[model samples]
Target: MFALRMSLVILVADVWAKTPFMSEYEFSRRRDELIREEREYAGHLRELTADEKIVDNYLEYLKWQEFIATEDKFLPSVGLEGVLDDIVNSKVFKTLKKFPKGGNMHLHENHILSKKKMLDIVFASEDFEHLHVAVDVPESKKWRLDFFLNPPAGWEKVKGNPKYTKEKLLPHMTMMGSMTEFAKVNPTNSARRWEEMDPMFSRLGSKVIANVNIKFKYLESYLKAALEENVQYLEARSSISSRLYTLDPDPKYNSTGGKRYIDETGGEYELQENIKFIEGFVKKNPEFIGMRKIVNSYRGASVSEMYGDMEKAVRLYHKYPSYIGGFDMVGEEDKGNSLLYFMNDFMKMYDNTTGKSLVPFYLHNGETNWPDDLESSTNKKDPVGTLQNTYEAVLLGAKRVGHGLGFFKHPYLLNKLKEHQTAIEICPASNQLLGYVPDLRNHPANNFIRMGAPVILGADDPATFGYDHFTVDWYEAFMGWGLRLQDLRHLAINSLKYSTMPKEDINAAIKDKWEPAYQRFIADIKKEACAVDFDASTNAPAISRIAPREGPMKRSTKVYVFGRNFEEGICKGVRCKFGNAVVPGSYISGQHVSCNVSGLRRRNRKGAGKSKAVGVAVSVDGGATYISYDGQFTFVRNL
Candidate 1:
């Protein structure tokens, strides 16, 4: 019975010993896996370090991705719909929701009127004559009088009887095309027909020309619309060329006729009238900020003529410092003499004590994309050079630059502008419509903003373009430039910051009004976001990193390995074994930094064979960089 019991005991002991051996073998397999993973991770790190350019590119890509994701989260919730409705209807609109509209820098007085208003002005004018109907061969058919009646000494005369109304005039007018059919060959007197029809059509056509009286009426209505849309300021280009009430002698002298009508009326009277009207309206409703002057000389005028006009403008400024704000050379750039032609006169006017510049000068410098010859027909020697004239204007001390569309093409000038903190007024829709650039996205304004240029947004001529200031321009800028609410707010602040308004007033508006409004907007956005539930675990996947290992060796060597998590929280620890025991050191986690294994040493190596080494020690910290690896094997080091 004792011998049988001994044999059973021996059998049990042998089975127990075999169980430990199985465990060590499994542990050894795992150790091999961990070492392979470590080496692969080290290889990846080395590769990334060697190619910094690639890493930088990747980082930039990551930044853009983050920006896009952030925009996705924030943009949709902005009160765009509410803002639009408010722009259309609100009477007391002070802010443009989140948009920062700069100024109406490119408005021309003649184009501000509606088509209906223009038609009314033409039809209602008591200036159409119903005299003997005569047809001209080349230009126009006209109803001419035997002799033109001159007005009394003080009052200007009308072409027709003052009693003639729109109802009476519709039957007398004859429309013609292809000039040849319009002119009847007067067999009796060729010279008489030519002379009579020439002056007749000229007089009749003057009524239909862009009228400034209609423009003033249009502006009154438009300003109300703009105020509802929350437009803060306007600077319109006004000219004395066509609206002068006073008469001048015709340049072409005639022996028989003493004087004929010339369209030379000093715009000062009209300017003053407009100013008074605006001031009176603003007094009742303080939301309407006043207007600034941009005196424009026609480009078709001679150098002397332009200089004379400019001189007259200076006199106007001197006469009414508060009303006439600044001076500008206006008209088609191609038709006008180069601005350089009047540089001497400009300097004289600029330095004049009598007409000190109360308002800032903003030049419409380079509005062309064509070659110099293409820009001008009369002066074909390439007078204005390329669009680089904008830079020259800046050097000559223009406070603001208008239609600086060629900014990107001049890098040095761009850099100079950046250095000088000069702002560029971008009119995206106007530029596109006028054939400056094709698309809003490809507009150089985006490039300017990205390159850190001080940029302001403007509506060149919203009425002419068949759009409102807010909808077409502000909306396009928002969609095209990828601008966020904060960016928009900053743009608004910038507009006020660079405004010609007094510094004290700007500060009051910013501190007392805009800042609080912006804060409320941001708070509202955050409140809306917080009410929603977010499940990051379902939305975002976990990324893993391999734990690092270190050991004392004859020389520095790198190991590499690769692995992926097939399931959530699957990444665990590395294990090694020797004889009948299992050992563990390194570990990895999805959320935190992985453990480092350094100062690891193999014991019982030669006797047990390389594969059956006893045990290894590791430092969880980087060697020398964070921890020391002593000869004595220890898992923990005293910091």
Candidate 2:
């Protein structure tokens, strides 16, 4: 016992006595010098005004690091993971949580809610009369949430049916269902995994489209969430399946006594109604900027079909202009038909006039590992698919391309992207989830910024990965990717510069909004950095917490889907059945079906003095079974 006690004392002495490897005074002096150098580094860094959150982040990091270096007590070694965890939970993280994410040019419509809200807002609403879920069997069965215009006769039969219970739905709700769940991208076989991820995302988008009644409410909710996270702008991508736009139909006012949102009796509302709703929302909350909608022409579409979509998009863009901005090409790039496949036909209809192209495209290019995991043997024939897509997007004058991750593959591609000032919508979370980059530390974004190529951060499919707003995406890039404060400002500036907004508006926004915001940011930095170094002699500021970035510095995109059958390519003979209503020559092509709902007649106004209105149904397989769209059409007599 005496020997053991003596040994313990000797070990303690060994650690405390000579562990300094220098005199205690010298150690303290060197530490102070390092602190002074750090302060100097912070001062010299660019974009001081815009980097307040980053400054706060660095200060917090230094404070903890200083403690580790100066503390006399013995401490256990922490791994890199532990350090990252500390940063994730740090005050820096909270500050960054509210950093002004200038704009999210690339985003999916369905994934606005984080994990908790997905459970609460969506899955929890299963009790609603109109809400019904279909579990696609095979991959945990296909889980789809839909709204019923009128409760089908057998809806009650499946109410407690064991097959469609909450237990059945849970598998597709959380991380288990998110095919983009975190995992090391296997270089040898990421191809298969990425393919699986697509259907999962597609499935989610379709479900959300099917449940469009409360969409306006959700739009408000989504923007409110964006404001909380300090996102200034957003541009969401979704295909407008049909030209006919639908909102919550008032059942009682139409003819029905029940509260079926899509009941035919419910009167049809105009596209302008929803637009007005958004205009009011933005006017009410100055902090909430509006969202912009971009429609997609599914790449898998036929040449004529794509042209039809482009024509409709141009019409919408001309009519709404600001509300509906850009037309994009969306789908799995490698598997679907290439852009070149439609170029011959696409150019024929490019111009609004004889020779001028009015509708600009936002293409998705370079989102794949071309040589490594080709989607089809056909891709090998065009070995430069990624580069080709990038070129095509530029040639076609795309406003931006989402996930142009493979830009570095060709040296000239970077130069061209820079020349065009074409922004690459960087969705780190989405790309990582889909196995594009694998490790954020090695992300090509750093190179993109250094070379002055336009780059912006976005949350592609935020809901699919369980995120509430844009914050999760920006935060992940800020920390996980080792981006400093200055990098963040450059990104912010690029976002505004590359947006589809008018040049004059962009400049005014920068001068009026960005300038003032930056000034306030600098002031906040100065406030938190008053006592950074703690030497009795030095005047270094104390590293204190700073305030969160509050409200949008400017407006945001208030986007809502404009069409029905959001999925492109209406199958052959698929008909929208609305009970003998005069169909105004339906345009049937691919997934999109557009008919004039104005011809729809019901008992309320024209059809009868007293009769209940049911609803309209779409038959994908020529009436094998019927599915409902948002608004229903009824038969009225000849005018």
lDDT of 1 by residue, 163-206 (tens): 33434333233111111222323212323323332343332333
Which lDDT tens digits does candidate 2 get at residues 1-639? 999999999999976885553432235344546656654433323534324543544433433443455244211112111133343454555666555666777876556645445434555443344555544345543454544545433333225567655555544654325433233325223465556555556443444433444455566677777767766667787666522223345655233223334423211232465478777877887544467778777867877898888887787778777677778877667666777777876686565566556677777887776643344525433443534676677677777888888788755877788788788888865665555665565667757766667788888776665433465456556655546666777777777777777778677656665556655665666455443332232232121211111111111111111233312111122344445532222222212343333332233445353322335545434445545544432232321
At residue 35, candidate 2 shows an lDDT of 59
Root-mean-square deviation of every model: 22.0, 30.5
The TM-score values for the models, in the order shown, are: 0.52, 0.64
